[model samples]
Target: MRADRLVSLVLLLRQHGRLSATALARELEVSTRTVLRDIEALSAAGVPVYAERGRHGGFELLPGFRTELTGLNPDEALALLVAGSRRGAQAFGLGSALASAMLKVVDALPESYRDTAAGAAERLLIDPETDLLSRRLVDEEVPDAIAAEVLRAVFAGHKLRIHYAAVDQTPMWRTVDPIGLVTIRDRGYLLATKSGADRTYRLSRILAAKELPEPAQRPDRVDLDRAWQERSTRFRTGGDQVTVLVRVNPGRREDLLGTALAVRAEEPDADGWLRMEVSFQDSRHAKWALWQLSMDAEALAPQWLRDFLRNRATAIATRYGVSS
Candidate 1:
């Protein structure tokens, strides 16, 4: 596909806001004279074009400045607008700002792209629609701008003071120094340095980071990067690891361990029962396996393990219908 002329100009500007004649020419695959002429053309049109000559400097546009969509061909602009809408309404927040932003962009689009935009939108609908609509509103809902600022703060590596809601209490405002923003599964998380000897806060619980002064006491003890690694690994492997040697009927080997503790199935021995070693933790696992496996499991190593299985079985039998 041919590159849109509008997109080409923006790309050039993005790369060469302070670009040398030689550098811009190489980037655009054109002659140095052509690069000089384009710079003049942009400046004559008052496009905020500027350049500097030095070992470390070239062309650069000022930050936070955006060119008008008049630069983009109609079809390209409309396509972006429609695609953005499918992100779900609730996620768009208070003013339905996403839709409004799209309107501005679409208004800028030339007439030629209007029909194509409508046709494309009609054919494409957001499916399996899952988004912020599924959750109950908190203080962040009272003002949506907070959510935007919190995201910005996280990216900036700045401290945040947000009204944080607890699981079973009233929300309280807190100041946290952010370390890293992590995404576990689908949702985003701000891993930050918190007061009272903790250094992390969940973004969902934060109402907004309206203001932040400085860290109360940044932990010199814990390495946040290392802690993040350990936490992520534990999430996959369950809690503390323990090996369970289950003497099971040989043929049931694969199905037993695979369906049970979510461990790799092991090879069976000559005995009619195949001893499967699985990683687990505490007595809770022993109890869970005892009940689920029922007669199939007989703990082989560590006499305590076999005793655990038996004790759990007895407890279940005692607790069955004790309400009477």
Candidate 2:
């Protein structure tokens, strides 16, 4: 880590030409005393570093001394800089390291392109705080200590003991073989197995965690994308799911289909309506999703669902028709 710090320090000086001790300390996220010691180390190691005295003076590399690290074109440099702004790495407990790496990336660019690349990146936005719907994106916080433990087990191929709070269930301790960690939509999940059965746990719901000494019973190498796909498919198809036959206005066909899990069959009706057999996670999900389409979609089969909707509509009509 010290070696990494030393290399970053050299890159910093190379980029800026000169920086005060306080400035170097701030950029390196280390104490000024450490920066001074590293400067001494650099000079003693034959680097052409020299110091200047006075309030306006600071440390600088000897004139004409440049490290050969300018390989990126302006667009490539800007792309790297923009990607470095992502907060996803923070969820994996690499926030500080990501920041340091970004600094090095910017510093490595050619002097003529550095400022321009950085300025261009600043003008672009990724993952804005709020969308047009005025919904704010929130990042869940995982304590540094807990994240470190999770990452340690994941990388070291060890089993993990976690206190997980499943939805609608009491918190319980689980020992899982951590297959991998995945972050989606700013939330983190541990894709693991318990007794060789696939299980996924949200990092936010991990009330507590501990790493076990036993080696994890997972593959030597994992394809996370494939693993996620398989798990997602199983979850979608293997629940207490329901299938409904529904008639929807042809114009709202896409809207109805979008809410349903899948369309098993479709046919055009006499009045230009579309009859579809759709699947939903469950009856409640079916009712809720169909309710969103109001009169445009009607559940035609599963007598119970049709009766439920009829009763609901009747109650509403009854209420409106009552005399004052």
Against the true structure, candidate 1 has what lDDT? 0.59
lDDT per residue (tens digit) for residues 1-324 in model 1: 113322354455653355667766775567877666776776776767677768976666675445345567656765676566553333313234555455556544544665567567766655333446875322223345765776556555567778888656799987776655554432455566665443555556777566454433444455657778766565447655556766777655655655454455566667656766676655566556545766766777667877777786788889994986
lDDT of 2 at 65: 70
lDDT of each: 0.59, 0.88
Would you list the clashing residue pairs of candidate 1? 16-59, 17-59, 17-60, 18-58, 18-59, 18-60, 19-58, 19-59, 192-199
Per-model TM-score, in order, reads 0.41, 0.73
Best-performing candidate as measured by lDDT: 2
Instruction: List runs of model 2 lying over 4 Å from the truth.
Output: 1-68, 249-258, 301-324
Clashing pairs in 2: none
